[model samples]
Target: MPTRPRSSSSARISSAIVVAATLVAVPPAALAQSGEVNVYTYREAKLVAPLFEAFTKDTGIKVNTISASSGLEQRIATEGANSPADVLLTVDIGRLKEAIDLGVAQPIKSDVLDKVVPAQYRDPNGLWYAASARARVVYASKARVAQNEITYEELADPKWKGRVCIRSGQNIYNNALFAAAVAHYGEAKAEEWLKGLKANLAQKPSGGDREVARDIAAGKCDIGVGNTYYWALMSEREPDKKAWAEATKVILPTFQGHGTHMNVSGVILAKNAPNKANGLKLIEWLVGEQAQKIYADMNFEYPIRSGVKPHAVIAAYGELAADPLPIATIADNKKKAATLVDKVGFDN
Candidate 1:
């Protein structure tokens, strides 16, 4: 993990003195007494909690938080119009789209978000925006595969047969990759790639990205696909993870005319947020320099904002062209991606 720069909380505090003094003249005690907002998230606590803490420390807005990986949409649905959740944070375009489809999240008007995040990475109406991005890069075992030769299509070549390992096609990450395929190759060609790729796998699709790395390190497969950040995450968590990280290197694959598929960890404002003002504040704060720096340092994800470099581990992997297909296309073609997954029997 890269060293975290010192918190710029003082800079924020200096800026807030005038605002805090002005709010002191107001009658409402909500900004001072409770000084709090509530958040619901599907991401890991370590990845997002600090931002809320920083917001609290700077603006005096206490953040009440709940961290869960599943059934968030259902929980929000059950809460209905009475829900206290002010913000929603999570991954994958499908999850964000689900929030939009369910009408659980509301449009947020933030000039900051618009200027910092690309249009393709966010909804036109501002239902949500990506805070950070991860690419679906290939990892090749250092001993078995040489660099610069693998293309997306060539992964299915007969020479590489029984040389691949992947997680379940049902995984949202893989589904998004297929969605990218649909965008670039058309449904016909994308389905062909899925069918062919499925046939080349060395074993049944079963584990997450880190497991894919482990398989490659163990020689269970010579090559595999996974998000670039997982390798860094694993390496940071334990010494045992270093072997897997060292055994393989990241492959950009963007060299073959199309950039690799990418996804995001993003946020949306809740439709009936009890703290709507605070929600927008959070969104604005996230895309700003402070939170963007934390996201890059802690998660090994690329910051969506301009001028923010990737974390050191990610930097060590070198760089490549990202696929030009708009990431929003992933959400639009999601259904087709699923249909093709089924058509090609990808679950087998």
Candidate 2:
């Protein structure tokens, strides 16, 4: 973790500070004088800075951010009731469920959130709300694969033998996909599908999703599984990576009887939020049209709010027909998914 000086405008606290259990106190006068909110997030600081800055400009509420890649949930658990965290923002339903299960998040009753976000993407008790979504889809080599359509079950076909690429099966993104399989198919069949998918691996599962595209561009594989946003990012922002993006086409693969699998980047209210009112305000604003556009466009994600279109680069991939499998159902089967991954030796 990197260290930076704290200031009134923004502060980047290390995970070390969080684990050390040292509560950084805001001076009583500062707290009373300026309406502010403290956020601990797993989201990249650069990705969220613009949103926070916009919020401050509009509402005069100062935003303090603590960014880390992992261990945020545990750190909050360690801090107990004295935690200064007002909100927790993280990607993936698995992590959000972890926070909820760890008792770090409290239920929120926001009419704005309820109206803006679809029920399928949010917690039933309102412990968390998804702000944006990304589909888990197939990335097929443009030169080798001519078919525009594919299904998740088709990846197991022997015809694709030694031609599939994927990240580690234990990764939350893949885990959720597998969990969805469990939701649709029984565990026995989902496990069998895992073994078949593993047997089709071009190489031992490794690297991030972009690497899958890179491999496809390099002729290492004909098809790979990855999130939709990575292709959008590679095409628009990463000039050096554009070739990788150009080498493949996005294929929204569906379960045999269902729509495409989707995951989200979500937000939660802290159980002991000191500035509850302002935190709620921030949450409400995040789901609004303007803020939703900024938040989604920054990362090439689809805004969860109705009536907001995805960024043009993402829209080019066509609209996502997200599988209606409840996220909670997937989260519940996460452990079963992980166990099946190891059972199949997917990373080996």
Task: After superposing candidate 1 on the true structure, give the runs of residues whose Cα lies further than 4 Å from its correct spot.
Answer: 1-34
Over 4 Å off, model 2: 1-34
Global fold similarity of model 1 (TM-score): 0.88
Candidate 2 is scored at a TM of 0.91
Worst 10 residues of 2 by lDDT: 15-24
**Best candidate per TM-score, number?**
2
Go through the candidates in order and give each one's C-alpha lDDT. 0.77, 0.84
RMSD of 2: 4.4
TM-score of each: 0.88, 0.91
- Show the lowest summed lDDT stretch of 10 residues, model 1: 16-25
What are the candidates' C-alpha RMSDs? 9.4, 4.4
